[model samples]
Target: MSQETLFTKIINREIPADIVYEDELSLAFKDINPQAPFHVLIIPKKPIATINDIALDDRELVGHLYYVAKQLATEHGFSDEGYRVVMNCNENAGQTVFHIHLHMLAGKMLGWPPYTDNAKT
Candidate 1:
């Protein structure tokens, strides 16, 4: 088994989460600290640290994750308005968790100029 990440902890049922969606391959849940009225986090069950860490063989999995994110947005009642999907790749990019996860932000106007001036562009 892979070393337990914070996400693994949540997956193992050790930690609590407001799960919005789940399947054999992935899981979606509300973020503990939300940035918007309808903020959620989508993550794969596999322990992929980041996008750069993914193997070519995992291409399908990667695509599936994004599709699931879209599905969750539709199911969660944000299909009409729209939402933003974000993935922080590394520490320099403000990635708080090592495990790869997608943040779904909606329910309000999303402004440009992110959390910090250090954004890569």
Candidate 2:
């Protein structure tokens, strides 16, 4: 079991979301704060809090998340061009919502290094 989160509420339909896709095992929705023109969040119905919380039994669920990402990318017409699928593990990695999810972003030429910084090199 996992703790309740904002996503859990979204999953349970207590909160409204810009939902795009949903199957028996997972759901895909738009990010409230989209980082790109095409930013979507793919999450599992089971509500595993973090990547570290995943167990061997979750292998298929995890893979299904990837599959959903690919499917969404293809459907949204960014598969050939390229896209990004990311999962933040903790605070340092920018995970605010505790529920594990895949951040799918595209619709432009995304750059590397992910983010800019003021840290001295």
Candidate 3:
């Protein structure tokens, strides 16, 4: 087992989160601070630090994360229209948490020009 991340705290029932879906390998939940109408954070059960921090052995798990995100998006009624999946890799990429996670956002027309100068602009 790896060191505990915030997601782990939520997974262990220690922290509070509006969870939408979960399985042995992953967990999906509403973002505490949402950027859109349907903003959910899908995370792995294992505590990998970031995208670059993921090991070769975690390749399948990474792919599965996207799969589960898509599954949950469909379940949440965002499959037909559209949705955005994001994984911030590092501090420069606006990653607040050190755990590897996928952000599934939809239910609104997202703006273009994804980010600006170390912040979402």
What are the root-mean-square deviations of the candidates from the true structure over C-alphas?
A: 2.7, 3.2, 1.9
Supply candidate 2's per-residue lDDT for 75.
92
Best to worst by lDDT, what's the order?
2, 3, 1
User: Where in model 3 is the C-alpha error above 4 Å?
Assistant: none
What local distance difference test score does each model get? 0.84, 0.90, 0.87
- Alpha-carbon TM-score of each model against the true structure: 0.90, 0.94, 0.91
Please give the TM-score that candidate 2 achieves against the real structure.
Answer: 0.94
Comparing 1 and 2 by TM-score, which wins?
Answer: 2
Q: Measure candidate 2: CA RMSD.
A: 3.2
Candidate with the greatest lDDT versus the true structure: 2
The per-candidate count of clashes, in order, stands at 0, 0, 0
Cα deviation of 46 in candidate 3 (Å)? 0.5
* Residue-level lDDT tens digits of model 3 in 61-90: 999999998898778888999999989987
TM-score of 1: 0.90
**lDDT for predicted candidate 1 compared with the true structure:** 0.84
Q: Mind giving the per-residue lDDT tens digits that candidate 1 earns over 21-86? A: 899988889988888898888889999998789889888887888999889878778878888898
Candidates, ranked, TM-score: 2, 3, 1
